[model samples]
Target: MKQLLILCCLCFLSAATLAQATWIWYPGDYEIWLSNRMQNRRTDRGTFFPVFWKMDSHYPLMDFHKDVTLSEPEQVRIYAEGTYNVKLDGQPFEGTPTVITIPAGKHRINVKVFSQATVPAIYIQGNKIISDSSWLVTYEDKEWIDETGKTSDITATKWLHAGSWNFNDPAILPSAFTLPVKPMAAVKTENGLIDFGKETFGYVKLNGIKGKGKITLYYGESKEEAMSDKGAVNVDWLTFDKAVSQDSTLPASKAFRYVRMVTAGDIHIDNVSMLYEYADVNEPGSFRCSDDELNQIYDVAKYTFHLNTREFFIDGIKRDRWVWSGDAYQSYLMNYYLFFDKGTVLRTIYALRGKDPVTSHINTIMDYTFYWFLGVYDYYMYTGDRTFIKEIYPRMQPLMDYCLGRRDKDGLMEGQVGDWIFIDWADGLSKKGPLSFEQLLFCRSLETMSLCADIAGNQPDAEKYRLLAADLKAKLFRIYWNDQKQALVHSTVNDDVTRYANMFAIFFDYFNAQQKEAVKHTVLLNDSIQHITTPYMRFYELEALCAMHEQSYVLKEIKNYWGGMLRLGATTFWEEYDPHESGPAHYAMYGREFGKSLCHAWGASPIYLLGKYYLGVKPTAPGYATYVVEPALGGLQWMEGTVPTPAGNISLHVSTKEMKITTAGGNGILRFGSSTRPTCTTGTIQQTKDNWYELSLSPGSTYVINYQSVK
Candidate 1:
């Protein structure tokens, strides 16, 4: 009888342990709060530089609740980040009770918190009752009292499932969240100046310091940038008076490899070290090839991407570490093939969206707004997280509505006052009146909305969005498609064609075969049209080529462009690479000596290109339930890599004469072309075309194929 009782107790303990609690908040509230903290950290040479646009904050008051039925009476422990009140079954707990006993029955637990500085978050724990995303939270409770002190209706109040990540410990508060950091010594030091030897970001620590005066630390991504006290983007000035030696860590995290310290009075430092602050995300996807230079480029791209991926996907580690929607859009794509960190992607999306009364476009840029929609679309494509889509659907509507309301009389997007039409950083780029590129992105965004609406179960809205997308797509072709130019013009202002619209159209599959070919020749191949210098636009331009089976050409371009940056001693990729420029001029941008970011998120496009285009692994269905792997050597002798999906890693090894493919999970199709008929040892090959063949791939199976090289 005792053994039987112990067994029952063990079973109950296991069940209770399975129900773990995590810190929770109103969805996106913490993200907005954290982004404000991160974005405001930017400083330009000791001067605080914030975003030009208005910054939004979390709701000052929030109400969180959960409906639960307990089998036995239990005491629930509560922790909150702000001033709070607790209630059980519509009855208020005496006075913010830390532990409250609930009778054995059905009850609704509520925690209302108010905070102005940080997001109102809570963590609750009990044997059967725990706080998690399952709990619902809202900014407004809308519960009122009548004249007689009776509770009024709150039927109109909207609630959403709480947002949470890995924060499960009771002692750890969500508001006190920070990235992990590690201490590292400087590689070399000259007098007061210290160099870490590579571009890095984090808090600077001055060890064994005894000072009685002011010390100015100039931070720079490049050595030249660090040395130039006047030109450095971020600077930290410290005034200290200490009789005994002590260590002082900088208050704010800054990005720099070289730190030039200029001290006044009696300031002494024994040594210099830094705490490298970085996001805790694992790299599940990777790429390597036969070419050593290409391998080097890939490694550098990954590092550049990692450096930019922190609290959110910022544009760069240094100078303007603000989350730009357009730059983040590229980061999302690269993320799918590198870290596959969906949490970061969702966090970034939420941060960018903010709490919208629908004022201005995201990042105050027109194209950026569309890219935000596209980012959501890709997120769903890669992760098939319908709950996320449903949760964010309401937010999407307002943004889309904002875009729709801003359309010109011709029913196209035009740059209005305060709208930065940042298509690229190129000089003389037209932002005037009804841009075709904007219209194209608008159409894509609408299509994304349509797809998401269907997933979100808004049938009528889905159909409406579909019609809007179709109508806009038709208009895009009708207005911008230049038959003579054989490409969509940059803008219809004077019917001048550029590569942006035509390139995007090709990859988006908006064009028919003939039009795609024409655009490829007339716009993409034609150098007379304004060349896309920024790696940002080049990402799409090259993607268009890869989509059109121009991998061979695109490979050369990637090497020439990305490899050119490598030759210039770029430890990480640059924001923009202009091969024509020379010496320190290469480092200069925006009319400043060191304005260009040496490690921009968009510069890591090769990670996406090689993974998706060359390795040829992409989801044909959402969440990679079904995917396609069509490996292209792209002029390399051999290549092997893993592309991460929500399901698992889809690995590939390809050479001139043979190919091998394996997937951890998912239904996949292995497609390739060869001069001769291919033979697969593990699977049967079906000839899809004259020289093309396709093989069905099953999870946990390796398929090896031997074929004559077509190229």
Candidate 2:
């Protein structure tokens, strides 16, 4: 009762906090927002304001400038003529005829431009101050806005200016571009400020108006030596030629915050602006789910295809965009399966929406070990939503057929062998690579696909796939199994060395019992070369052992691996072990250990598998119709966890003292846990260190199960 009371209060407080937050504005309400938008700068704390050039969906806005020069920093001040309350860092900034200051810094500003009682042209005079004479002429440019309200790109012409700073003036220039909607300017009108519906957005522009000509920027090896915060870097000694007419091209370094133009003489001018239809997206938010944050990540991952087209969402709220960086595909797939097995209804629907049939499926598989099949299998294990299964089977069938249909002449699936013989884990072993592993993975996915077809009542397809998979397995054994090694060779063509490949095949039951035991012995006790050791050294060792039911070894590896991660200052997993040089995201090393995250999804998979199998909490075999209650504790102090299964919520509280388990509050029967070893069939069970147990029970019924301890 006390816990429930506290939970209620916490929920209320969270709701209130989100409701009270508001957007803030900065530097008064002037045209400074235009400058900020182009540079992708944010101010007023972390609140994002719309770009001046790109207005909101409804309003049209635009701007162009004639004078361009880079000295300290100068601005064409915008005068607000109307009285309004705008935001500054989630706080309100109000009043009329406000002055906007533009400094040479990064800032994303937001300001409202009002209309006049009559038609008034709003213009701000360009300001320039040229203090240097030794600088040579560099390049010039022209700017424009795409007012069409759709996808548009603009370019600038590059040329050299020969005149001196004194000759460059704002009076004479090129054609004046029309604003997308209304423009903001200071003038005497009937109303103090013109009101133009809601606010619009766009960019500002600066043509190559020359002053002291173009200045070639120099830099040191490091940012510290380049220039100081006080602008104190001496470049007076470096000399270059005067400006000559050239194409306006942006270099990689200048792409971020600055644009440079040169002149043959000493003239320089600067302007950058454009109007765009944009919304405020930098609102501070994250995917926060109490029970399944990992699964939430997966739910978001399926929408990777949307990254190029649209922003993501959880529920209906939009989310930040995530790109596919190639290094993180493992994390993405694992998350997909985690959510799929947990039965997140919204996530399931979201998965349906992400289906692109060929491109997405192929991308998910070819790029990441054909790993998508496990998620599909898990989806069936969680929901038993036959309708959904049927819908997806056809879409995925073609691809599955392709993999199964393309076996070698010997009937073994033909493909490049992955780094080792193992399909799921990717690491190099002596003389082994990725092809054989990929073939194994292809074989595994086919078998699972056949089972799915059977469950969907597509028996003919199931039989066909099943027969094909069986034939492939037989040929694989005939071709790859080495009689001398008494284990599966790394490759039939190479026959070079043996490693995790044979063990993985045995773990997945791709071999018979005698063969499986022989391979297990070879990996765990027989082979010195493949023995599991350090967490980093044997990253996938525990999972492989678990697949082989080498409980003692699995337990040992788990303790060492998990403890090492915790000791490494990991709050979450990381892409690598060493905290030091993991790339731009340096802080990620402090999170979890998701090494290479593309293959293993690392820390996430370990946690999920431990929670599901070791904790004896799992989904029912027949989808959500029931629950599986068998958990493997692997000699932990104690285990307490809750998994959201299709039947309802399955809670697990295992007493290590007596090796007993207590399950409560779930629908269907606990099918897997017995007095022996727990192998989940339906409801729940207490898994022993080295035994097999199964359970059967109904929802809301209390079941107490005890197991004999091995130690």
- Put down candidate 2 lDDT per residue, 1-711, tens digits, no spaces: 999999999988754553121111111111122212222432211234332322211112211112333445554333222223333333334554244334564432333333222111122322431212211111122432232212233464321111111112223221121212322221221211111111112221223444444443322111222232222121111123325422222211110111122224554433322233232222111121122433333223222211111111111101111221121323322333333222223222223223223322232334232545655665566566665565456546766655545555655544443211223332354323334555566677778789878766677778987887787677667766787777776666576445555655754667787777776676446655444322222434555566554545665554445444444333333233433343334222223221122111233445444544555455545554655555555555455555555444555666543333334334444333234453333345543333444455665655555544443
CA-lDDT, candidates in order = 0.89, 0.38
Clashing residue pairs in candidate 1 are: none
Report how far off residue 214 is in candidate 1 (Å). Answer: 3.8
- Which ranges of candidate 2 are over 4 A from the true structure? 1-361, 364-369, 404-406, 415-434, 455-457, 496-500, 524-527, 530-540, 547-552, 578-601, 624-627, 659-695, 705-708
Q: Residues 25-117, candidate 1, lDDT per residue (tens digit)?
A: 989989999999989988777778899887888998999999999888988889999999998878897888899888898999999999898
Best TM-score goes to which candidate? 1
Clash counts for the predictions, in order: 0, 109
Most accurate candidate by lDDT = 1
